[model samples]
Target: MSVSSVSVDLYSEKQLQQLVEEISLRFFDKPFRHRAFFNRRLRTTGGRYHLQSHDIDFNPKVLEKHGMEELIGVVKHELCHYHLHLEKRGYQHKDRDFKELLKQTGGSRYVQPLTERKVSYHYYQCQDCGGMIRRQRRVNVSRYVCGSCRGRLVQVTKND
Candidate 1:
């Protein structure tokens, strides 16, 4: 397989944006002004809002492991801080503005934990004959491939 192989997770970028916008309106009664993007480097954090650029960063792993509902909760949590601070209200976790907004909007008080991670599959290939395989998880396909000519690579049996 060439380095060009691209694997896209289930969620699309547009979907994330829609979720952010929806949460902003539903919770703060205000629009989210900055962009939201997945930060691949993010590991422990679910989401972060930059005070300087006013942009929102989210860990894609949060959505990949969890579901949409969990992602929405994270967005709501971030928006609580974003809106309150922009309004010149205390937005820190200790501040009254932050506490009030969180309760009133029913946003999460703390970051939710991501779901237990499952190993991701990006397809597979055989070394001997350039045979390609697809799988949901890594497999020792070496013992399982083209029975004829022993052309190592076997197309993954699963639709995924």
Candidate 2:
């Protein structure tokens, strides 16, 4: 079978919920009362913790591509958000408490790319610092200047 058509059905929805509950109790010393299930719609993020319903949705691609270890790390990360938010602590990523708890729990800070999407970039060079900048969309060189050294930017031709 082609790699693109390959699929992984490692766990059922009920099993996913059980796993989340187990991880939450083990790592956070709390219970996961809400639902946890696979979300096929998730694209870039490994998992998402909802604020309204208190549910956690996981991207199956994490297990499919990276395996169980990475999936556990992602579960820990989501549990960090779930528990902290429920306790009315700093649950957001920018908060210090979230960072500390994430560190303590050994949660993943970033997930590997789930799928490859081809994006064409416009390359630019700074005249002063000689630094290169890559942008997915065409940048307005006339209006925008280099973030560092405040230098004029010139577009560079690159065939990707």
Candidate 3:
């Protein structure tokens, strides 16, 4: 049996702006007067709201990898920051108002991972303490020592 892959068309920047505007008006009952566009440079974050410019920059990987629903959730999350900040209310993630607004709008608190980390970890063992340490890069045994017991470290193995 063969599985056919369906191609999904992503939205352009102009369409993204329009979508943001519509979501803002419908959910928040407020108009998004600033610009919204896809930002290809965004790596881990789903979307970012500019404090000074009030513009929203979205990671295209959200829609590309997740789909339209996840992208909308990201838009809502950014809009929470946008609207609250503009209103002179609490806009930061830790603020009560921001949390309330985010919950009411059904915004996503965290986005799915866009890409997997391909980093390999180097495992080390402390001679004195028998503690294990994991590092992405190799640590020099001559220079670095274990903090717990000041023991010399020996490389155990490398794992992906």
Candidate 4:
């Protein structure tokens, strides 16, 4: 999928629930009556549906990295759990109803890992002379120097 910059209006909690309801209607002939929201603190998992609260929490990283389509699939996956549990059908990953709903709805079997997401970098520079310095690992200015002028390379603040 194509990558896009972070967007704030991606989906509201109400809009997400509506999306889930629409997907359920389109594919499963059911309605999704639950809460859905973006959970920015979610790290590795794409989405989670709570049985007790009947709320779906999504990973914001999915929108940041994989964009809209991937986010939709994640919502569908959570809807699988939401609908099945409410209907008194099997609602867990290993249950028959859950698996069947997931397959029929074309939902992702599991949330993708966040490791593929883009990461910001920390950059350092030399102040004494005009030079470029880059390091994933921070460099100690006391030991590092600009080779041309034999001038010390002061550690400039990082970009990230």
In terms of TM-score, the best-performing candidate is: 3
On TM-score, the stronger of 3 and 4 is 3
**Can you give the TM-score per candidate against the true fold?**
0.62, 0.72, 0.80, 0.62
Report the number of clashing residue pairs per model: 1, 0, 0, 0
Ranking by lDDT: 3, 2, 4, 1
lDDT of 4: 0.75
Q: Give the Cα lDDT of each candidate.
A: 0.70, 0.89, 0.90, 0.75
The digit string of per-residue lDDT tens for model 2 on 1-160 reads 2222324558788778877887877788888899999999999999999999999999999999998778888999999999899889999999999999999999999998999988889999999999999999998999999999889999999887
TM-score of 3: 0.80
Candidate 3 per-residue lDDT, tens place, 43-159, comes to 999999999899999999998999888888999999999999999999999999999999999999999999897878899999999999999888999999998999999999755
The window of 10 residues in a row where model 4 has the poorest summed lDDT is 1-10
lDDT of 2 at 79: 91
lDDT of 4 by residue, 1-160 (tens): 1123324356676666666667777777877666678788888889888878998888878877777778878878888888888889999889988988788878888666777566655455566676777666777778877766767776566555
**Candidate 3 regions off by >4 Å?**
1-8, 125-134, 143-160
RMSD of 2: 7.1
